[model samples]
Target: MKKKLSLTSKIFIGILLGALFGIALKWLPSGTLKDSILLGGIIKIMGTGFINAIKMLVVPLVFVSLVCGASSMGDVKKLGRIGIKTMCFYLVTTAIAITLALGIGKLINPGLGLDMSSIVTTETVIAENKSLVDIILGIIPSNPIQAMASGEMLQIIAFALLVGVSISILGKKAEPVKILFESLNEVCMKMVGIIMLVAPYGVFALIANTFATVGFDAIWSLIKYMFAVLLALGIQGFIVYSGMVKSLSGLKLKPFLKKFANVAGVTFSTSSSSAALPLTIESMEELGVHNSVASFTLPLGATINMDGTAIMQGVACIFIAQIYGIDLGITQFLTIILTATLASVGTAGVPGVGMITLSMVLTSVGLPLEGIGLIMGVDRLLDMTRTTVNVMGDCACTLVVSKSEGELDLDMYYSKEENNIAKNA
Candidate 1:
């Protein structure tokens, strides 16, 4: 007899087992099973490996897909139109996200009553140099090869788009380069498949190590702050995106969300827009985003698509201020909006950049950065949710932009296709 399980079943099993083992190790005493074998070794190793494997695929996948996207765009005006549309979408969505977060944070005042002594803070000395100029300059790589060599995704993206656009001008000559990259893109996706096979084992170890010593007690302690941030994400995902879809696309939200649901799940697991860009782009295209529009919008969205995170940052900052009993004036809140948006440019592509940006936000509003230490314990956990929202936001924006540009597949966008059969069906 052969045993075959559904994809959802497999993923659920991974999540369920990881959660169970994690809780056991965290709550139970220092038993041998929890220490060297279960908690100490296997879980941490697997989790780190999984994260690294996913990250390793981020740069090439983004570069190649974007290159393919640009090469497919036969005109400069299309590229320009797409870029302007994507940027507008990103900026507008980001502003909306922050406003929603800030509004809720003010109303809820989660930080006002929380006890701060219960959380753990990492004391690693970090370099805090962040500015708009540095981020802007970094986008154009001084050396393209070095950018790729160092995994500088923005720079790699810039170089790839330039090369891709120039290929169109070459007429017949660009064929060889396009063919080579298209083949490479296929190879990179193959690698993602191989990496995904180990996902369960990776998730198991990661969850185990993360929870082995993680005191849920602390989490329960700051449930108020967590609730505020989570509630904000929920509102943005449910209310805001729904309104955008209904008003802009004139499409039913359920069917649309159903199509790209898997991409959102993957993004939450990865906590990376760039890592999730391929799936996002694919999902968008399959769900009717025209190739030129998707190529233009999705890549740009991946680079600056921090809407969910920005919302969380704003809410988290306000909550911290309340907890610290720091009163911020209206000007300070406006300053936060400026800093948050500006910080996003620097925060993109940097490992663990959210907290650093949060630190900047807190500092701008006169909130204690020490309060970041309080939320640090739960950041990774909440990151899962925010990442989901980020990917979903990108998808929503792609749909609307493509629609407005007259590049959307209306039939595919509205149809609900089965997971395994979607591509062929």
Candidate 2:
């Protein structure tokens, strides 16, 4: 009898084959065969359908799972601590990512000889630079129905917390509601499992389509900028995340990376952490994090933790400044970090959203928005890599919280057999 392949192995195989298939398509003649029939028709359908399937689960999963996580927290103080720690870890990592990116960009001088004379500035409406007051007020959700209809995550998070806390406080009176949410959370997690059975094909289609269309030419044009962003991502993922996992959870780094690779593949192909959340939760559980921590931290991380995006913003800001010959003063550099860190909160979990938030960062540093035009061509590919890093940050945060809360199972984390048993059970 043949052994069943693990999901991680399947996902990696899918990514390898998909990349090769895309490259083959890129080599095809420049006419209808490659552009119209292959990329536009078949590839588009498969990729878009898969993303839609994942997206359909995001809001429901976040709401139901978060509600369950919150209500299950018997102690309000512990919940508060979890919230504070989670937010602090996410923000601190993002700041570190930006700082690292800036340092690398300066050393590399990615934009030293770049010419922006021909880059035209369009008067696009930039993302609103919300003040602290505005951001606080906005979280209240004047109309929660509208918030849900629009998929407003921060508002949804706020509303869910309210419901969960109320249920926790009410005790017996809220038992029915709490039980219903727990059932709903279980249903959503089961949905994630079912959806993931087809995940290999979905990841294949998404990646193949992306590579077939975008090709490598765009990347060559801005290689330095890409390298800068990727360097920061590499340092954060390998050095920072590995260190944290070992120190905080006291688990061997190898097993964590092995489990996280599956989640990384999903995030890389989809380029949307929100879409990747269901699988992230599953991957975290497979790595032995308790469901309460996985459910809460993963959702919260998807919404606000954006170390990857911040790294790109930081690198891009520096590159643009060098191109325009604008020397960033100390205060300007600090503002860039602060603005990018805060702006990530309002950023949506979707493809190419880094561009939107980049606009905010640039404006904060008095850089030209047209500089974005230079990076747009290669942004798609960078977005994929950075998003993988973003989700890694989420997983790392989940592990940290699980350790602190005594919710992590080291035996499960270290033992492959134990993980399989838990999955089978």
- Per-prediction TM-score to the true structure, in the order listed: 0.58, 0.59
Model 1 worst lDDT window (10 residues) = 118-127
- TM accuracy, model 2: 0.59
Deviating ranges (above 4 Å) for candidate 1: 1-78, 115-221, 415-425
Q: How well does candidate 1 score on lDDT at residue 282?
A: 83
Each model's C-alpha lDDT? 0.67, 0.73
* Residue pairs with clashing backbones, model 2: none
- Which lDDT tens digits does candidate 1 get at residues 1-425? 98897433454466557657778767777867766676556664666556555655655665675576567556435467766766667777788888888998888877664444222222222223446576557568899988777655456657877887787667588899989887986776677667656755665555454445443533443677778889989998888887897898787776677766888778777777788888878888878888877876676666566778888888887776665455666656665676565444334543344654565565444455545434544566688788788777778888887888889887776565444457776
lDDT of 2 by residue, 256-319 (tens): 7888888888888878898888889988898789998788888878877889989998999888
Clashing residue pairs for model 1: 43-205, 111-323
